[model samples]
Target chain A: METREMTCINCPLGCLLTVTKDNGKVTVTGNTCPRGEDYGIKEMTDPRRTVTSTVRVKNGSAVKVPVKTKTDIPKDKIFEVMDVIRKAEVKPPVHIGDIIVDDIAGTGVPLVATKDVE
Target chain B: MYCRETDVVIIGGGPAGLAAALAVKAAGVESVLILERDTQLGGILNQCIHNGFGLHTFKEELTGPEYAARFIKRVLDEKIEYMLETMVVDLKSDRTVVAMNRKEGLFSIKAGAVVLAMGCRERPRGALGIPGFRPAGIFTAGTAQRFVNVEGIMPGSEVVILGSGDIGLIMARRMTLEGAHVKLVAELMPYSGGLKRNIAQCLNDYNIPLKLSHTVVDIKGKERVEGVTIAEVDERLKPIPGTEEFYPCDTLLLSCGLIPENELSGSAGVALSPVTGGAVVDNTLETSIPGVFACGNVLHVHDLVDYVSEEAENAGRGAAEYVKGQKAGIVPEDDTVMEMKAGKGVRYTVPAKIRPATVKKDVLVRFRVDNNYKDVSIGVFYDGRLERSVKKRTVAPGEMEELRIRKEELDKYPEVKEITIGFVE
Candidate 1:
């Protein structure tokens, strides 16, 4: 059996979770929220995150409009994900909520503009 | 739809916005409007069911909603104009905000000065890299608080906490009182991030053990949270071997930390300070943008709600004062902003940019250290000369450190352009 201790990031309660694995079965204990189970398993296996940052713009008075990934992506693909966003550029007079990168890295998460760039 | 114009348009109807509204009223700005995304005026305070708030400003014990109500009631008494269920969809420097609601399908408000009091948001599991099976037993501290206090729902029978922040500490007792067997409140930090009073009242009062220098290393479950593993950590925060222990439970709550909600501010071309993850503001709480101001958790992660209220009032009044042409008219003196960096046991400081003499307000530098210490003094240096000093009140990396530089003391450094603050023997 393999066991591990983890902090449940599901809530402000920050429940300490105990994970015990026997053969192929996994058991999670110690959490006050329902999301802790999902958090723990994903954290142990394939971790992902929703990256939020800015992308360069062309012929725009403003430097950049802050953007974020609409969906979480695999942790290993963060740098590759950001690289695609950095290489991309757009024109000015763009409205807020404009999609900068759609289906980025096949995460199906669109990088949307947080503000207008004119 | 009714169209309106104001000198200042504040977002988020929480205590921060309410305090800002009152400050604008005090500054004689009649054309001020507050747009709240929530139907209730009190914001999240309405869901917080515990006490241990209002220590600095009120010198009395109060609950979250009660503390927020103080400002909300004042906003009503002041007759501050506000719109409920209004979500600001678009904000632009041209002084316009595209807001929408059920009552008002689509509307716009124009203002000269804008205050961002959107407050801070809880960092969720997705932010933390925890491997686990997708189940229904995980929740955030704020979400649990809402469920327990507002919806009267008991999340689980057995629980364990991961962070030792004030919220996590408070929830330890809250969950216990709600008839849950709380195993432990583990923190990666050596000391607690919550106030001293919370440690005694919340964890200690309930016989709940708080394990320091501990972290959750692993999790397990298929349908629900079946268990969690905790381990001691070394100086680098890497988990140490031979110290792992498994605790069985059905749920987990996360209170790691709160991040400032700056998507809107960052989008509006507002510069942010890495220390607090908020905006760089001058003494008047005005951002780099001439007519923009910020306060509350949106400005920085505050230790108390009282401080948030204080800053909101300052931001509100600053916007009002600027609209009235009474705020600081001097430019930043060409990047003459002071910088405060933590030393040996220090971490980060806020208000990343300090505009000298912009206002007569007493300057207080608030920061957090990197570790726990005894008998230390925080020193402020201007060009290698001692400028101000404050005695330590048991400085800990978990708790924020506040150092005051009186107006007169700051005035002494007439030629000082930049300053650095740190702690020394």
Candidate 2:
């Protein structure tokens, strides 16, 4: 059996969660809500994060436009996603929610613009 | 000097100002004008490009810019008047505003009501008093954020962050994602000043070490930063000898704390709270000057922009009520004005004083804990009796806590003169 402790990030409350793994069974303790249990189970298995960064803009009001993954991606794919976004640029009249990169870092998450540039 | 007249004049274009303007207009006030110092409407939210905004306002997670855009679109749709690059140089208690801009050389506005939403400024290195040479590599966390997120410029290739506030924690991850090696984040306090979610997602997930009870003791460099020497601090927050360690970095970011920008408020003869550093407002969000209102960061630093919008709405509604010369409720002179006091284990509370007549439904008193506490209850005491108490598993100085006092409850204590909020273990 293995045990790990982590702070649940699902909400601002930030309940401390203790996850214990034995063979194929997982038990989470010290959580105030069920979301903490789900977060613990996922942390023990597959951890994910939503990546937010800026992309270069051309012929726009600003020099850069901030972008973020529409959903949480695999934790390890953050740098890879950054690499793709670093080399990417968008044109003027770009609206918020515009797709900047499709399926970023092969995480099946689309990078969308978070600001409107005209 | 050019002169104009308006029913209401808001002194900012940020989330607070925008929400206030919308509420003022919705309250049947016409000719509302917003004066913005920046070239755009979003204010700081434009540079805060990170997500995690609007969860309470929009019911969906959004980036700072996205959240601002939602409000901006509403302002435009509502046809509210606003001037970009306009700076309010002087504000008087009589609702006279003196402003200037390139387009409008000098002008003044006689407003029926004024809403101060100038927001807050981050505490800089000058305030920290760290023994360091004046170096170009040092930047406030918000300035660095603007550089990376807006200007597309990297502050440095290697970074060391001082103060584990949310901005510092966010920038640590940002600099790392942009290929900078963030050596570590050293915080002076025993506990982090940032939200727990930020510490977990921005620092823990990035594998960045957060050294609490540590602070920068020395800075090495002449023209630019070469390195920083950090040392562990004792219980008194004094540096302990022989615990010094040096880390080489080209950049250092400070995210200590935010101070409410109230110079304009002071100039307007608005009484300020030493603890909040903002205006001393009543339950209606009106300052000592009857027609003047304040909200958002300019009134008190808030953890969430959603709360800022809500508070600004209250200010806007109050200002509109003042302009219309009618209030929702009448105050009886016999009822004593109640003072909100911060008791043990708690910091200051907003709405420093409340007049029983101003509360139509309920009044929300928000405050922060003085220290990190576990398994505690927040007790609200009126006069000498415990009126209400709430149990919390944990509370920290970094997060703001709130409690609602219904009007019916206050009606029961008409002669109550003081309300104390304290922690009950």
Candidate 3:
């Protein structure tokens, strides 16, 4: 049996959550919402996080265009995804929702631009 | 010298100014002009490339630029007039604005109403009063952010941030993502001044240590930042002796705080609230100078730009009403105004005065606390009588809270002389 306490990052409410696992059964308490419970369980099981970053832009009004993962990627792969983003570059006239990287870090999560660059 | 006249003139082109102009146009104001000192429409939002914006206004997470773009698109679509790279030098009590730009050497505009949306400025190291030699590597968190996110320049290899403000917390994660070692973030207050979500995603997830009740004691380096000395602060915020710890770093980023920019407001003879460091206004968001209105950071530092836009819209609408009233040859009747007083644990509230008669709808009184409290109830009193109380799970100084008082409710208390807001234990 093991127990872990963490702050739920689902939203700004930041509910304090305690998760306990016994015999492969998990119990989450101190959460105000279902999203908090889900966050606690996933944080304990396979922690994942959505990555927001900027990639180099070529001939754009901005030197860098902000990008983020379409969905949460595995927590352990954050650095790998960041490394790829750091080395990647995009051309001008990039539109929002444009995929900057496909299958980022083999996580099957695409990195999409958050803002348009012209 | 050139002279022009407009019904309403907005002093900035940032989120606040853009929203104000749009609102004025929507309110049926024909002549509205926005003057922006920056080369672009978006102000500080241009450098704030990180996400987590517009969740309230747009119902979706967005970057600063994305949020500003939404407003810019509307402004362009409406064909609102605006001048980039134009700076207003002076504003008079009569709504006379003296502005300058390269294209227009010097120009003056007389407006029926003016909205001050100059925004706020980051507190620099000089304001912190830390004993230090003039170093080259020191920069405010916002400046560093602009350099990295906008200019694609690396600030330093190792960074030590002072003050756990949102900007500082965001920079800690940003520098780390850019391959820089963030030693730690030191905050003077026992509790962090940043949003809880930022403390989680920006620092906790990254394993960046947040030292509460700690501050930078000294800065070491002559030409560049070689290191910084940090020490724990006592309850009085005085540095404790013999608790100094040194971290070798190339850069020292200060995210101490933000001050509302009100230089023009002062020149316009607007009465400012010492607590908010901004102009004092009534429920209509009109300053002491009747024709001038203020909102956004110029009125108070806001945690979210969404709120800035909302408040700017109110100011815009207020200015439009004032302009229309003036053109109609109608003088505003002096109505009974009630003063709003901040009680225990409450810092200050915007719109320090409330005129129930002029209020078209409910008035939102926004305020902040002096410290963090958990499971507390906020009480609103009308002339020493408890009117309403709201239970909040948690409240902190970093986040601004609001209590809406409906005019319909105020109508019941016609003889109300004062309203007080405070935290109930």
Error of 1 at A61 (Å): 49
The runs of at least 3 residues in candidate 2 whose Cα sits more than 4 Å from the true structure, single-residue gaps closed, are: A23-25, B326-336
- lDDT by residue (B1-425, candidate 2, tens digit) is 99999989999999999999999999999889999999999889998887788878988888899999999999999999999999999999888999999988999999989999999999999999899789889999999999999899999998999999888998999999999999899999999988898999999888899999999999999999999999999999999999999999999999999999999989999999998899998888999997899999999999889999999999999999888873344444544589999988988998888888778899999999999988898898898578889998889999999998889888998888898899764
TM-score of the A-chain for all models: 0.79, 0.95, 0.98
Better of 1 and 2 by lDDT: 2
Model 1 chain B scores worst on lDDT over the 10 consecutive residues at B326-335
Please write out the lDDT profile of model 3 over residues B1-425, one tens digit for every residue: 89999999999999999999999999999899999999899888888877778978988878888888899989999999999999999999989999999998899999999999999999988898999898889999999999998888988989999999999999999899889999999999999988887898899989999999999999999999999999999999999999999999999999999999999999888999998899998888888898899999989999899999999999999999889999999965757889888987899988899988788779999999999998888998898778889998889999899999888778998888889899765
Which candidate has the top score in DockQ? 2
- Pairwise DockQ winner, candidates 1 and 3: 3
Using TM-score as the measure, name the better of candidate 2 and candidate 3.
2
Report the number of the highest-TM-score candidate: 2
Interface root mean square deviation per prediction: 16.8, 0.9, 1.7
CA lDDT of each prediction against the hidden true structure: 0.75, 0.91, 0.91
Q: After TM-score superposition, what is the CA distance of residue B173 in candidate 1 from its true location, in Å?
A: 0.5
